[model samples]
Target: MSVALDGVGFVHANGHRALTGISLSAGAGERLAVIGPSGAGKTTLMRVLGAALHPVEGRVAVLDVDPWKLSPSALRKLRARIATVHQAPPIAPRLRVVTAVLSGRLGEWTLPRAIASLLHPSDIAGAHEALTRVSLQDRLFDRCDRLSGGQLQRVGVARAMYQRPALLLADEPVSALDPTLADATLRELVAQSEATGATFIASLHAVDLALHWFPRIVGMREGRVVFDRPRDEVTQEMLTALYANEHTAQGAADSAVPMHLAVCRA
Candidate 1:
């Protein structure tokens, strides 16, 4: 399995629980989408899978290594094989696109080489190749600050591609993109994972895109997995339930299908 979480649970420093009993597994080359409303623990799940956050009460094996159990250097090595694209692209404002893309290999490169590469990007061709996949090669020399939110998101995708990771995790990757651009970007991400036989998992609020692109769908609600099923098997009823709020007057029980969640059947 590329990722495995056994009874995972996470709590914030503020004593708020973000996830509970998140037992899930995904194999290599599998494409899965996590769909949920805001504060549904979707981002927390992504962080746990990417090994960026350790669960307080469960075991996690990413790329066959338990990140929390490994030595510092060993954990870093394990993390090098995993790539995560955040909702916001974490690129420096003054950094050129090429430099940001090349930063994907900083984990693999030596300290001296990495420092030199940052000063003078020696992998221009490689960076350009990655950018071209996301149709952002024209912005290779542009500073990150000059790019729009969607463009910056695409740069994050390009960097993930350059990493050639065994596991790719994206959190709301297409939130800033238009419908057409979102579709294209998702296609590019899936294509890269398919070509490399890497595990691809994305947390998305767009249910239509998730159903259209991913074969497997995992629904999250209130820090729990509401349902995990094939795309074809996910029903509008499930979606309504997944997005239900007990505090609201219009709960899932009152929600009608083929209306608000018509896209699930599409």
Candidate 2:
């Protein structure tokens, strides 16, 4: 199965052009990374790919089904085959980590069952297994607000993993963590998704991390795709130029800085 966009364009309600004639495609199990500076339409593009947003122009197809043409129920069914993890953890702060993770299965369960599980999470074993994959099994019962930023992000990943989707869309999944944690979390995410042959499309600001982890990289600038190539074809010079005049390099360097030293400086 593949997700393909043909000349897709989107304009926000506020009149901002979020994407313009952006076209791309990803096959199953492909690890594609979208890299760009802030507000470069990475999120908008990902949303479109995830079927959360419909392009005002052009066409988008996931496994031969036109996303925009689907009925409400059909759209919901299609979405169950794709999962998205946002930059910030979207779990309820007061909810237990296990409950939040188990929520991923809600789409496949009946409303009554989902509501029943909220009282006594239906998939304890599955949730525990997911947490173990992310090395957070010990914190399964912890409140979402109690976990550190890195841990919370892992919880979000666990939730997505429990869905067993065919395609995963992650927006800055590791941006809030320290470098070591970011690398570890990203590795776990990619490994887990690959185990299920799910395609991954992650938007990342750290060019080095994207280069190291993804086979293909797509570069965006001001709502336009400037470059799309394999990792071997992308050079540091190309990345430097793509994010020129922005603080991408500075952000990358900051991620490389030892957290202990950064804390001492703070």
Query: In terms of lDDT, which candidate is strongest?
Result: 1
Cα deviation at 38, candidate 2, in Å, is 0.8
Query: Which regions of candidate 2 deviate over 4 angstroms?
Result: 250-266
User: Candidate 2: deviation at residue 109, Å?
Assistant: 0.4
Candidate 1 lDDT score at position 59: 91
Worst 10 residues of 1 by lDDT: 249-258
Candidate 1: TM-score? Answer: 0.92
Residues 1-266 of candidate 1: C-alpha lDDT, one tens digit per residue? 99999999999899989999999999999999998878899999999998889899989999987899899999899989988998998899999999999999889999999999978998999999999988999999999999999999999999999999999999999899998999899999999999999999999887777877888999888898989998877776677667766433124223333333345432
Question: Evaluated with TM-score, which candidate comes out highest?
Answer: 1
RMSD of each: 3.3, 5.2
TM-score of 2: 0.91
